[model samples]
Target: MRRPHPASRPAPQLRIKPPRQLIAESGADLEGHGLRRTMGLFQLVCFGVGAIVGTGIFVGLSDSVAKAGPAVVLSFALAAVTCVFTAFSFAELGGAIPVSGSSYSFAYATLGERTAFLVGWCLLLEYGVSVSAVAVGWSQYLNELLNSLVGWQLPDALSAGPGDGGVVNLPAVVVILLAATLLVRGVRESARATAAMAVLKIGILLLFLAIAFTAFQAGHLSPFATHGAGGVTAGASLAFFSYIGFDAITTAGEEVKNPRKNVPIAIMICIGLVTLLYCAVAVAAIGGLGADAVGDKPAALSLIVNQVTDSTVGGGVIAFGAVVAIASVVLAVMYGQTRILMSMSRDGLVPRVFERVSPKTATPAVNTWIVALVFAVPAAFASLDAVVNLTTIGTLAVMAVVNVAVVALRRSEPELKRSFRVPLYPASPILGVGFCLYLMYGTGWATWLQFAAFLVVGSLVYACYGRSRSRLVAPAAPGA
Candidate 1:
């Protein structure tokens, strides 16, 4: 056979989705394939808030406090800074692309299809497992509320997971199913419910601040940096989990009205509001009760409120608020997971069932149910401690990818019309990636191993299934 000249051969092509195509497809109503745009700025902001203000503040605070003492406030600030950098990247790409896949779409547009599939895989860990973790936290507060109001609570056999000496976490399973039901109804209905819950939870946190501050003592903060810089950094790693939901805002790009403008603005607003609230709550909790008392206590805020006011009524109110707060997180995060899967399915990276939208609801009804049931098993039997670190590491890994995607997109498509831009260009995104790695470093080695194992499975699945089925490689079949 005659050898062909190297220069005459064609360059290998990469499977990258065009940014314009993503935007155009988002607006097209393809029979049962399109999602309705019903959320305005307020609803979008509420959705972000609902997702961001859950178990981290309500239950995980104790773990942070145990590590950093009074300096947990600094930990919150550190995590906020990390999120701010990534949120800027998300805002820019979300405005330009405005698709349902969030970081997965960003990756597909800037990086190649294989990278996008991996990013989507990480998101499954982030949103789906986080829902289970938050549900477990919700069960804790539910018990607190029940005991406070009725002087009775579910027994250990019914209230906790197997890891926690219970047969199943019934409340966790029930809450997840309820959230799935609400999501199947429609985005508008879910938005309204989330908004109402957002307002109620915010008010409850404010009330906690008021009562907690009444007992605030400077003496409580005397030894602020008790465990030093390493402790604060580790606490910040855990605190990063609290900021996970802000990016969930980008996941709603296809379902938000005027997403190009509203998505970016809502992201900025959500981050600023949630950051302030988190720092304030951290300060109030530490100041009201000395660091020693706050450490390693489950439902720390409610417990602090009870102690500060010397009454169970105050604690009960906060507990009830926590139950509401955590439930909203489950709803919002589950919604995000379904949308990401829907986007992946449309690209043929996953099963087609995920992409199917219900004609009557304008929602991925079957997909939502599948997500709920899949995660409910873990919520029923897995321990909260077992899932929290996995979720945090997965979330950090996904955010790092998004930051890299921002830099890549800027270089590849400088002319891309962006409604919002990262302030420092490459520097902002570079720092975002750095911060993510820094936090990931602070996590335990066991978590890194788990994340690594997850990636291996994801890569294998992509090689065996997604790679061959991807639409970029071959057009979808008729009616598919």
Candidate 2:
């Protein structure tokens, strides 16, 4: 018998059922010199490290130190443990799907269209708000570095967002625009830039940790749990958001070579490395400067370095690192946002404009710039705390959903090949979900209100645009 042409076979059983032309169209959009599958485990690991290590270690550390004292080390442990379990679930789904949109796409493929839309909406909140928050933090460092080096500073009104007294945050907007421009160019450039920035920031952290550890004293840790267990949990919840980017390593599923093996390894390895770095830095900073003092100085790392070495060089180095690190964080997070939009557009959950890739770059250029403006404008003037609080809630909610997805997929597709599996089956994912929910509860009433409001907005979007535009809504789905 004559061998059948590749196109003659039905699409994979697990494949999204749309027209063959639609499938081809979607595949074609991803082809060529765009954000193609050029990244391997190393590049992907750097992506995770770049995105996760920056804001958390730099700006957020002081608050965690204040809340838990030296016991912030324990808080890091708690957050890491929680993430590891979720990482396993992410690894399984990421490998099984190997598609764009990360969890949003996974949910759509397995959970259904409506849940997918909700996830996408939550992700928009998660990524968009996070970029705003991180960029604001970056602006602070940029302002500081400029003042120290040139004896000049941007006006407070100009440097911060609306609540911070500025009508608009000019620096945050500039950085967001810069990142958007890079993303629209190509993925390889974006990934390479991320890797370089990750190295500079992590190196600065190591320098600080090494210097601070030398001054570590046992007495500073005396009141390890001064505020008691409640404080530690509260601190853990706040710190939990700092670790948000660990899962970004898995987002490169389609691009990672041998994704099953490489993605899981990269996820676990990056998490372990980042956790160690965070715990060590927390311990050293608390031991040397005292937790209360660190909190008062939001730019604690730079302040501590200046005091320790009695020189501007140390502070300058960290400030430089902060600028690069936060920029990388914005890039990675924004990249994740565009990919989700790309998937949604293809699925007809968002406008077709989001699905259209520029032939020049093979990237969702239009979608990325649109999202950048949407996020950057608010970020320029908004308070960092507000953006962070909202993002934390959305991220934790999605992690909980992912934990459930892991167990459901295990049972529902028992024989399906998975590159990675949660080591302890139901218990691991259950514990992961539990930890995430507990943290979500700790985000306070205000955060919950913000999250609820966003969810309501999401529902309305789904009712209006998503449901009507959804590919599945058509009797025979058309190519996007």
Most accurate candidate by lDDT: 1
Per-residue lDDT of 398-444 in model 1, one digit per residue for the tens? 89999999989989999999999999788999999999999998888
Give the range where candidate 2 is weakest over 10 consecutive residues by summed lDDT.
14-23
What lDDT score belongs to each candidate, Candidate 1 first? 0.91, 0.78
What local lDDT does model 1 show for residue 76? 94
Superposition error at 363 for model 2 (Å): 1.2
- Residue pairs of candidate 1 with colliding backbone atoms: none
| RMSD to the hidden true structure, all candidates | 1.8, 6.9
Tens-digit per-residue lDDT, 261-303, candidate 2: 7777888888888898888888888887888888777788888
Instruction: Show pairs that collide, candidate 2.
Output: 161-380, 161-381, 161-382, 162-381, 169-380
Cα deviation at 255, candidate 1, in Å, is: 1.3
